[model samples]
Target: MSHLQAHAQSATKSAVRPEHGNDVSPHRFCVAPMLDWTDRHERYFLRLLSRHARLYTEMVTTGALLHGDVKRHLQFNAAEHPVALQLGGSEPDALAHCAELAEKWGYDEINLNVGCPSDRVQSGKFGACLMAEPELVADCVRAMRAATAVPVTVKSRIGIDDKDSDEFLQRFVAVVADAGCRTFIVHARIAVLQGLSPKQNRDIPPLNYPRVQRLKQRFPELQIIINGGINTLAQAQALTDGSDGIALDGVMMGREAYHNPYTLAHADQQLFAEDSAVPSRADVMAAYLPYVEAQLAQGTLLQHMTRHILGLYKGQNGGRLFRRHLSENAFRKNAGISVLKDACALADTHASLPPHEQPDDNLRNHA
Candidate 1:
């Protein structure tokens, strides 16, 4: 078998149903769907790191799927199995159609996006704004569940704006759960619909992890996965295993997973209890080169895929050189795998230098 196939099978081994007889959720260790970030190329790269961590597509709106290029929005590498397609729309019929499309396109799950606080999303009458209208959200969920056999999940903030009350969240979850949605990925911050930019909304709102845990406490049967501010594999493990008083069903890591992509290198072993050997950073790069080459031949721009790997060596020796080399050269016309090789070589070379012998900013600039 090819090394990639071997990695996939190895990860799947640990995903088997446990002795407890409860189905292990793919949600247990998910990488949050960030717009313009978690595309097919990035998902493919992440799969090489951990076979079992669930991946999500960026929010594709019903309008985009119905009127836009269907293939561009739906096509993905088969290696990204166990991946979900997150949809952005509140109209029941539109969402129902989208959910049907998602299942037909081979998505393992269909997630409704009710937590994004972006103005663009709000103007569409979807996203975190839906938090205020529990009944409408329920209708959307009901329609989606009717149209697709794949699990229909919802991702929402705990509350939105002045509706930041525990009772409000409870009512919302209860309504949606009654409508056949079994999983709710809660970003444990009250989305301030009016004052915050989308970027600010992610950070400015203080995280109410306790509130999410309490949500789980109230509805113990429904799968409740916590999102927002979780940064490391250790944190993901702790939250899912109930390191605190309440054991959540899962944890979703966002920017940290992207900016420090290698954080997932140990997920299969650490989170899924897999016994397979972990791939080193060098090993991951080597495995990914062939993919990059294939994409390059298929007319994908080298920069599109290379941009995702800039964080592969993040915080390691020679990491800056690795990033700098790619940032400087990957965008050049006709750039190919050679540029990536040179970047990896620079990282290796700088890491081999003695601490005192390593180049400073000035020397690195010239190098």
Candidate 2:
């Protein structure tokens, strides 16, 4: 059986039901909800790499749904199933309304964005700053749960700024969970909202996996999945299998997955145990080309889709040439499917050569 087919078959057998409902969570392996990175096209591309990794949409604020283009923000390919929509806002009523829209749009889960440290998110009274106001977050969760049958989840930091303590985190989780949130995707770093930039916040804060592990131990009933600094499959396996003592639920990978998406190629078999042949980089692009063509026919710019695949050949031979070909050509006025095909040809050509015969390019070392 193909890995994707096997995953479909074994999904029910591997599901872990929470105390509240029979809904099987796709939380075991998830890709973080990055602001501009996890869009519909990107999610569809990643889906071709791994069928079991739960995908999340980039955060859509209540204001966007309430006033802006709703179809643009909520519409997604049905193939991207087990997908979640990450909403950014603090108002309970607005959140509830958006939650209803999420259900109407057929999203599998509704995740509140409580972990973004951007200045924009703070000005709007949402994101990581909400960790300090647990009661308000609980109200948001309560209202959202009432609006839809889909799972209402939260993705928050360990703590925010000075409130960076175990007790503070415990209180935040306790309050939100009390309002019907069962799964928590915790970024192990506290958001330094005062002096750091959002990019700095993702890197500067030292990761505290043990703190998150303790969170699972403290609230044994909640499904606690740890995020932040998880870069490898070995690391992902260690956390989920609890090799270090307390096994939480799962691991959410961010930048690593984006820069080297092929890392997820073995996730279905290794992480979910749906054993089958892993798809090669060529196999992935071959499957994705048809989707690219369809999107292009629908007026989507080729650059928007091509940019996501630039990192698909990150470490392989001719990877630099592949990126260069796309980066230089895909932005042209009439760029089409042939641009992608040519880029793939560059990667495939150099990949078949001996190491010594390959072109002398070391830029990937710095990339």
Candidate 3:
């Protein structure tokens, strides 16, 4: 293996979950709620990598739960324990109703999404727009907390537009905390609403982690999770060392999980320090194969699922061959687990390929 890959693998094996000084559960690492990116299949894949880290479902709108197929939207694997359902809404009654339904669906926690800055969300009068109305957010949190016994939490950007100030954030937290929400996942950045798109909002916003740390210091009783632009295991570990936890989204969940899955395997060993063996990409593909076939039988496109696995062999000896073979063959009519076997075979055969030829660039960019 290349030196960087070797170091990553070694770090995975040595990762340790730090003990928090507070009364919260020890699952300090969390997968952030990403729209369309953190479905059940992705959550299950992440669960295979780290058993103890908390997983969050994508933001399900309160309207969807109240009017749409709530069960299908909330469906998840049994193995994905300690999972939280993130709900998006501004209405206190609707949010409370959705939280009740999520609690009934057996989620470990109910999180409020106040961080998403999409225009569509703003038109719906929710997401980061709620940041402008702390009173409304507190009412929603209060109602949800009263409706469900599960821990009610909020995920928000540091500020929106000109409202970016410590005073705004402090009052926002204080209002919600009074409403019984104790956990706050702060995406430590100010979101620009006018010129930036939602994707740019995630990237262009300057990360102000110290502001989040200050929030933690100010409200020692609140569990503050830092999120935004944290891409490496080292970064995750370092952030969690100071904060209550670290929340990772597209950067870690999609790109990193696909490019260097071994990081997760390393996280299992180093963070959890559990002797449990990391499953090979082949093993993961084998396990997921039957599920894919079943979904296909029901007319689901392979792309829906395969898109989540494109980075499975990132940074490995035959990473490109593995990704290329799978990318080409996985969509064939009636493709099965045997396709994964072929991909693995390609990896084995091209193990001696130079690093430049092994698709690490694709892995890194996507990751």
TM-score for every candidate vs. truth? 0.94, 0.92, 0.83
lDDT of 2 by residue, 1-367 (tens): 4444333335325432222123323587899998788999998888878877888999999999999999999998776777899999999999999999999998889999999999999999999999999999999999999999999999999999999799999999999999999999999999999899999999999999999999999998899988999999999888988896698788899988888899999887778876567898988888778778988999999999988888998878889889988888899998999999988988998887888988767553311
Model 2 sits at a Cα RMSD from the real structure of 4.4
Show pairs that collide, candidate 3.
12-266, 13-266, 14-270, 15-270, 15-271, 16-270, 16-271, 17-271, 255-367, 258-311
RMSD for each model, in Å, please?
2.8, 4.4, 6.9
RMSD of 3: 6.9
- Residues 195-290 of candidate 1: C-alpha lDDT, one tens digit per residue: 899999999999999999999999999999999999988888788887876999899999998999899988888888778788878778877887
Estimate, for each residue in 192-270, the C-alpha lDDT of model 3 and write its tens digit: 8778999899888788877887787788877777777766767766665643343222122324554455556566554
Candidates 1 and 3, the one with greater TM-score: 1
Clash-forming residue pairs, model 2? none
lDDT, candidates in the order shown: 0.88, 0.88, 0.73
TM-score of 2: 0.92
Cα displacement (angstroms), candidate 3, residue 184, comes to 0.5
Candidate 2: which stretches are off by over 4 Å? Answer: 1-25, 360-367
User: Candidate 2: lDDT over CA atoms?
Assistant: 0.88
Lowest-sum lDDT 10-residue window in model 3: 246-255
